[model samples]
Target chain A: MNINWGFIVSSLPLYEKAAWLTLKLALWGISASLIIGLVCSVVLYYRIKVLERLVRAYIELSRNTPLLIQLFFLYYGFTKIGITMSENTCAIIGLAFLGGSYMAEAFRGGLESVSKAQIESGLSIGLSNMQMIRYVILPQAFSVSIPPLGANCIFLLKETSIVGAIAIPDLMQVTQDLIGIYYQTFEALFMLVVAYMILLLPVSVALTWLERKVRYAEFGN
Target chain B: MLNSGISVLVEGINLQRLLAGLFVTARIALISIVIGSVLGIMLGLIRTSKSKVVRFICRFYLEVFRIIPILVWMFIVYFGVTNMFNIHLSGELVALIIFSLWGAAEMSDIVRGAIESLPKHQIESGRALGLSFWGLYRYILIPQAIRRLLPGAINLSTRMVKTTSLVVMIGVIDVVKVGQQIIERSILKTPTASFWIYGLIFILYFIVCYPLAKLSKILETKWES
Candidate 1:
């Protein structure tokens, strides 16, 4: 069947709105994940025995469970527990929080790659642990971590599409509703494929470029 | 009301349904990983390929998966082409196809990365030893590559399983979809039933996935050791 470009074009504004929501969710989610992942990773990294085990367990729990299930837990389960938020907000928070646990390990791996010699070197220069992380380990680990961080961010962005399942009216969710209304599953899904491709492809390219820039900075090249 | 809701939810989960879901999920994952690994190996080989055309194709394939969300693949197969082609495909079949397509591209990149990361000395040494093409790959190459390859693949499998959640949107009756059905029914019967249904769904997924995550870490440490 020939495609209806007009019908797809007519959906552009809706797509734009959905795209904006997607980005908003990504921004909030990434921000939460970065903060949570960094703090949790550090705690997991340097905290003493029992605390370290607890952090490890938390990471495992977050990593192992399906994010969709987590969203359902938040959207459907916790509402009864009096921890309700709007579905959109729930999805964003769920994604960010789950994304954090993964990001934390990425941070941990990056930090861990900063060898003992470097840490001792930082200590010799009279920097405290926090200072060493901010000044020494992080800067040096930047190159090592940049690639994984970039990849993880892309993964996190893609994963955010799950919010659509929770009826957050994201790009995918909108497509579902459009399909329901239009009864043209093919056109609706084709538009969705293009929409996601347009939205996500550039974001991935930008992250790669960002990582490359970080690489050059790390090398002072 | 609580007791009956619990019974209904638990009724939805039994050897048949749980096993069916798990079986479908595991089958989709295994098939994707296996076939994808094959395609990826070919692509990965192409990365080191001397032919310009081969290298370009490999690069393009890697970029496709690297950028596009897995959902797009699902949509393209399940939503876009299936009806147009008049193919009688189940959602599970569509999911498998999409996952394999996605997996092949991912596995290729991992393979290429691992191969590239190997010590240049090892290859040169193999050549120096007058080893044949198979000799070098079988002996010097594959072993060294295994350690690096295992952890990434483990993580990817975890990813694949978690991603099966997307199948729910397409009517796969996955854990999340089941949870959704429970919630809807609960709303009609008892509003509070939604909470326990979702909570149980979460625990089910956790039971399935958490171990893989832990195993990945364990493998990472073992690799380091």
Candidate 2:
């Protein structure tokens, strides 16, 4: 099997640009999901009856369905109604929705992990409910949730590949394009796989380190 | 006008075609799960073996599969390998292999976790009682691990079912593919058809997966109780 190394070398710049787009899209999706998750967790924590059920249904639907279909529903279904957006915009929104559902669970677990005594102590200090959450609960919960949030981000990065199906010129899209031109399928795909590993491994390692630090700080060590 | 759009969309929908699509999706998922479980069990065992090379290889397999998107793998098998090997496999067959490989990676991790989580003393006791390695696995490790493994395995199956939707992208003509085809044909008839066709597809997937999700949860709670 002849693997063409020269083709991959020449295509480095294209892959690099695609990698940047992937990261940018992933960052946007991760930020939006984090914000949504935080809001939903806070709402769930407060036990607001009606909104709680609504959020639960949203989470279940997003979590259960294939994210690709979600992308299609938003991308194609919206066009049929004349509400057309760019593929990148639709992808970010679709990914954010998927990540948000999973992150809500992660945040909920973190929020639950914050001891009741911590909240009681905040109350004893004459803090209001809002202040108690802002000052005490959210900080603890944020640290507790970081690792899973990191995993969500990594998954979001992987999910960005799906947008290529809709013709978003992301990494996978560019890879497929190069494959069509060069017919160096193995070399192109191998390089793209390695490109992803390069992009993702650091995040995984950083998250693990941060998790360790959070656990240590939680113990006052 | 609203009623007209709904009527137009509903008139274009075909239940038999959609059901056929759903059957293909189910068939692929079941076969993928069975293939994954077998490969996963072997990988899981290798991961726990005394040989460093075997463990390293298993770890590499698990990590590589976990990090890469399933879509890329599907593309590699369908588009890339076929270009090089001069061997033609059906799209459905390629998808089956791709999902099985993906599922095996996930399942191995689940199995490894379940086995490692067991108490060390149980294995030690079994060894002390003169059981061979296979005997120890059969008598002690597996029985305990199977309980913990069941919930995760079922959950993986559900995930497999959902992800099999990606196969449609590679030309497997699963439910999502059929939905897209129906939508394309009917879009000229009524733009509303795109919405309803995809919506119906979404609900069909939900109908299939929700029960499996619940079953996994029920099994989890039952095992713990």
Candidate 3:
């Protein structure tokens, strides 16, 4: 296979635009998840019996099913209910909802690992529940949560590729679109792989570094 | 309005085509699992070998598969391989090739984890028994390894079933693609057909994955004591 420098070079503008879109979807998706996850995690942690059951049901349903099916449901379901958003918004919402379930579980796991003795110690000093959590529990939970949380973020990056199915014009969609019109499938798509590598590999390296930093802090003499 | 009843709409999907789609997906998933398991276990051994170069190659394989989304991998192969090689293969065959490659990479890690979690004494004791290397691996190492691999293998089996949907994107007419075609036609032009059809798709995937999940849970409990 002769290298086609011209095709790859011409496709650069499309790749950059798609990469930017993918970045937006991932960044906003992760941000939305943090909000939904914190609320859902707290519900699992502190909700009364009824609310607890609701939370558990939601989490289990979300976790066991494939994300692709969930995206289909959101794309198909929302439009049925007279709620229509742009394809990009729909894709972002779908990712945030699907990714939120995983994030909630991560947060709940982190919250469980926090030592109860410290919370009791805080109470002894007249700290309220909110004060104890704010001042004490969160700081500790963040460290234990780093590795899994980073893993979830990495997964969120990959999951955004499914948005192409809904025609959201993110990285994968752009690659497919370029191939559809150009009749130059392999070259454009290979660049797509390289494009994704450039975006995701740095985040992975940064995550490993972050994990090490947290591990060192925990073990420092 | 896409009425949700289109999957089984009295006229939308003939009984024969629906059953045919189910069989096609099930068969593809079975072949991929069987092939993937054999390949995965072997590569897994290679992955855990002491040689640094072989180990690095295995780790690289695992990492690339781990980060790259399976669907994108599908497109790369579906478009790239067929045109590059000028092969006139069917879509189902193409899907099987790509998915099996993915399964091998993933299941190898499961096998690696299962092997390492065992006590080091097992390997050392087998050597102490004066058994030949092949004999040790055949009888002692693999028996325990089989037991550990069973639960994870079952999980991967279900993963294959769910992932076969990606083949639909390549135009293999799997369950999702069947539903998609129905919704695009005359009776299903509205929204509900897409919903209910997808709802059924969700149920079908759930039903397939749920039992393996439960069985794995039971097996884990059985192993715990």
Candidate 4:
């Protein structure tokens, strides 16, 4: 029943490196998803009917299935058709695609929150569609989008762990790797839990602060 | 194109294996739902108690599970418990316990939300009518909470079905694990086996999840009205 605190202490440096890698993967993945989400949201917002069906299919497919299967499908399944990519590349792409679907839903909600009156005002002043969206719709949508987007970021952070299954060397991968080598299961797993807490605690706190700030602004604070 | 993948089927043995794998997944998810709902409802009730300490403990349990990945939680229980106590629980047992814990945390939130949204006058009126603590919840509160909880509970059920795929990471021979094995075995016979196998898994998942998701939505809108 004894936990090896000393072993965990000795392994702090390796855990730290893995933590950094996890953060990097989450950052790149979230950024890619946000871009994809924004574009998809824009297409849907404009009522682009033909593309909307394709986008909805992607979103529903990604949302319903397990992310692990998607990662495997891309990582292992692709090589069969003469497409090859590194583990890390495949992880990023998979994470981005998954995150993008959730982000698109958030963006759709945000875009809808931009009041119809504002768009009408832009039209009354002869503002072109692009100009109206740029000057009026986006600013408002950005505020409404912050909270859900932040939640999605946290979700994506936890999802980065799955990349380890594909041998991407992220935080969870490192923990599992350590477990395999050292056989210090409790120590490694405990360290893994603490490492995630360390990363998520501050990010969640900052998100709450950001949400409050945005809400305050909406209230003219 | 599709017929090529079906060519490997011999008296439906592969199909039977896939079905068995799916049965494992379903059994795990269903067991977790029942266990989790009971545990979650208890935790939810505890969270809404007047005692600050009780509420704090329940909230902590809920938040920790909410933030951590189920895969890590699975490892923590499966490996950490085995290592620390030298116990030899099977992977399926470990997965069941971990997923039930996860289900409890999620259900607690739903239960909490449903309870909080109810009118306060009911609780007060029950108190005024001299209902005891247990009587108040049993006679008045729980029935309403159960009604309000149905849509969310169903949604959680669907989510649990999807999330059970994580057990594959722990070497549990669930549907996705079986699919992986099938592809590996058949790879020599057909280079596209992985794709065909995974595509089937996706469809299976979609067939299972899509209807539940649709039901959840319908219930939600129905309840809202």
Candidate 5:
């Protein structure tokens, strides 16, 4: 098959717009997830009574299902109950619903890794519970959680591809549309792969660098 | 509203078709897992090979799969390759191949981690016993790694099962597609049908994946102790 270099060039602007939209969605989705995750992890860490069970169930349900079905349910299923949302709203909510649980797990791991001895030390020094969590627990947990948080960030970014199913016109949707309209399957897919690589590879590299820096800081101190 | 919703699900073998679609989904995941594990073990062993080129190649393969979403990969194979090569391949076959390749990439990482995490002394002792390289791995390395990797492998299987939902986009009659068709057929008569159908699909996926996840967790805690 002959390559269509010109078609690829012509589509660059369209892809650029779609990539921007994808990045925006990912940004909103990830930010929402971080808030949700932080609250849930704090509850779990403190072993808050009634909320813990609800949080656990939410995490399991979110983690087990696919983002596509979640989007479908949010966009299509909820209309019958008189809860309607725009496709963009549904996409962001779907992403956050899935991502929040993974983030909570990562945060939980970090929280658990802060040793009992450290908490005891804080208590013995007359640090109140809130102060203990703020000064003693959070700093160490944040450092430990950085790597997993970065991984979750990347995972959520890739998951934004499925938001196209709800017609948000992200990168994946644009590529599919191009393929359908132009019958330029090879060129369309080529652009899709390149766009993602451009989008993902730098974040992945930066995260690895950040992780290494954190590890060295831990060791150096 | 409720009666119409129930009828939409029960009408004209709809539930049976949904079940059949689910069967196809399970079949694809099961076959991919079995085949992918075999391939992944090999790739994982190669990843730990002493040769730099072999390891680099393995890493590249894993990264490519990791970076691209599976839906794009499905489209490339299901549409691009078939169109380019002018060969006819069914949607199910493409779904199987893509999922297996993805599964292998993921599983390889798990296997590599397990193998690498083993204590170094075991290999040194095996060498001292005059075991051949292959014999060393067969007798000492793989057996121990299996225990370490089982939970991770089980977790990957659950992920693959959940991901098979994407095959619906490629025109495979997976459970999600079945639900969509049912909703489309009954939308005017029973506008509430989508809620029930999609909810059922969600629950269906939950039923399939939740057990494996629980098993992985159980094994992880058990082994940690």
Candidate 6:
């Protein structure tokens, strides 16, 4: 039961490759989710009738279910209906689907914090609806939303671990593959944990820094 | 084709097996929630302790859990730890331990936030009344913090339930695993069985989680007013 340093060293190349794939998936998923979230939150904020209801349902459905099942449905079940997608595609879509609802909730919270008086003042200044949303509302909302949005980013990043289940050969998948092949469970898992820490720690730190940077003085200490 | 898929759901005690799997999932979540809450409350109280070292330790624990994905933790425990220690542990046991620890870390933060959010004057007033430290917590802090923390705790419970789906990866025969088994067995006869099976699982999870989430919202709004 000695530590297999050599084995871990040899696996480094494989781990690096898998880590890149994970990073790629997370980046695409997170970017897509941000756009989806922005659109859905705007619809909800504006109280658009039919689209609002549809968005609400979509949000709940996405939020309540585990990302694993969503990936399963997309990767496996969809083939039944002739909607075949690549593992990477399914992984990205699943991550975005889950992340979007969370990000939408975050954005909605930010949008709601824009005071009614602020909106009226924007209108008083002859700001049109789009102009108010663009100039007045968005800046304040973005500031307010930074922390939760950052949190959603990290959550979605960690969630990329499960995309291994779809055979995407992400970090987790690589770790399991190493374990299965080498039967060096401890060494494989240690590398897995290290890989995640390497991936996540800087993001967490940067987000904290960003959250502080965006904190408005008028919001009070 | 749809009829065959539907029949796959109800055929030969399949529904019962899925129910049993759901029960296992619910049991894991419920037990972990209870244990996690109790431990979390204690850790949270310690987190706000006067001692800096204790608070630092609690913070470190929370950060460790936060940074690592739960799936990795599962692998480490279910695979690595047992192998390293040369001891046997069931997948369900490993899942319970990991989930409880993770939940406790999360719940502790919620507890700490709730307790800290109270006005400083509440503590000052309690001390003025000649209350001991424990007396202050019992009589002044905890009662109020419970109401504030309930919505957050409920939300965490829903998260725990949803996350229990991960146990299947560690070889626990949870609801998701049961669905996978059914689909594999019926895939040839009903190629669309995966659709119906996974869709049912999606709904089952929704049924368990959505109400809890809704209740958390309701309490949050009700108490906000």
Best by DockQ: 6
lDDT of 3 by residue, A1-221 (tens): 78788999988988898889998989999999878888888888877678788877776666556667777877875676677777778777777876788788889887888777877889899998889888778866777778888999998898887888887777777777777888788788789899889888999999999988877434222
- Superpose all Cα atoms of candidate 2 onto the true structure and report the RMSD in Å to 1 decimal: 2.7
Question: What's the true lDDT of residue B77 in model 5?
Answer: 96
Query: What shift in Å separates residue A38 of candidate 5 from its native position after superposition?
Result: 0.9
Candidate 1's residue-wise lDDT over A63-160, tens digit each?
87788778877887677767779987897789876888878878888777777887787898899878987888778777777777777777788887
lDDT of candidate 4 over B1-225, digit per residue (tens): 445755543324888888899999999989988999999888887778899888888888888897898889888887888878788988899989998998999899899999998899999999999999999989999888877988989989988998888888888899988888787787677667777777778788888888888888788788775
Reproduced native contacts, each prediction: 0.78, 0.67, 0.45, 0.65, 0.79, 0.86
On a 0 to 100 scale, what is the lDDT of residue A153 in model 6?
Answer: 96
Q: Write down the worst ten-residue block by lDDT for model 3 chain B.
A: B1-10
Which tens-of-lDDT digit does each residue in A1-221 have in candidate 5? Answer: 68999999999999999999999999999999999999999899989999999999999999999999999999999988789999988989998999999999999998988888888989999999899988888878877899999999999999998888888888888988998999999999999999999989999999999888767324213
Chain A TM-score vs. truth, each candidate = 0.90, 0.92, 0.91, 0.91, 0.94, 0.95
lDDT of 2 at B200: 75
Worst 10-residue lDDT window for candidate 2 chain A reads A212-221
iRMSD for each candidate structure, in the order shown: 2.1, 1.5, 2.0, 1.6, 0.9, 0.7
lDDT of 2 by residue, A113-140 (tens): 8888888888898999889878888778
User: Model 2, range B1-225, lDDT digits (tens) per residue?
Assistant: 324455543463466778889999999999999999999988887788889888898888888887888888888888878878788978899999989998999999999999999999999999999999899989999999999999999989988998988888788888888877777777676767766777777787888888888899898999995
Candidate 5 TM-score versus the reference: 0.96
Lowest-scoring 10 consecutive residues by lDDT in candidate 5 chain A? A212-221
Ranking by TM-score: 6, 5, 2, 4, 1, 3
Worst 10 residues of 4 chain A by lDDT: A212-221
Per-model CA lDDT versus the true structure = 0.77, 0.85, 0.80, 0.86, 0.91, 0.91
Those runs of model 3 whose alpha carbons end farther than 4 Å from true positions after fitting are A115-136, A217-221, B1-8, B12-16, B126-140, B143-149, B187-191, B221-225
Candidate 6, superposed: residue stretches over 4 Å from native: A128-131, A217-221
C-alpha RMSD values across all candidates: 2.9, 2.7, 3.0, 2.9, 1.7, 1.4
For every model in order, what is the number of clashing pairs?
A: 0, 0, 9, 0, 0, 0
Candidate 5 per-residue C-alpha lDDT over B18-65 given as tens digits, one digit per residue, 9 for 90 to 100: 999999999999999999999998899889889998898999999889
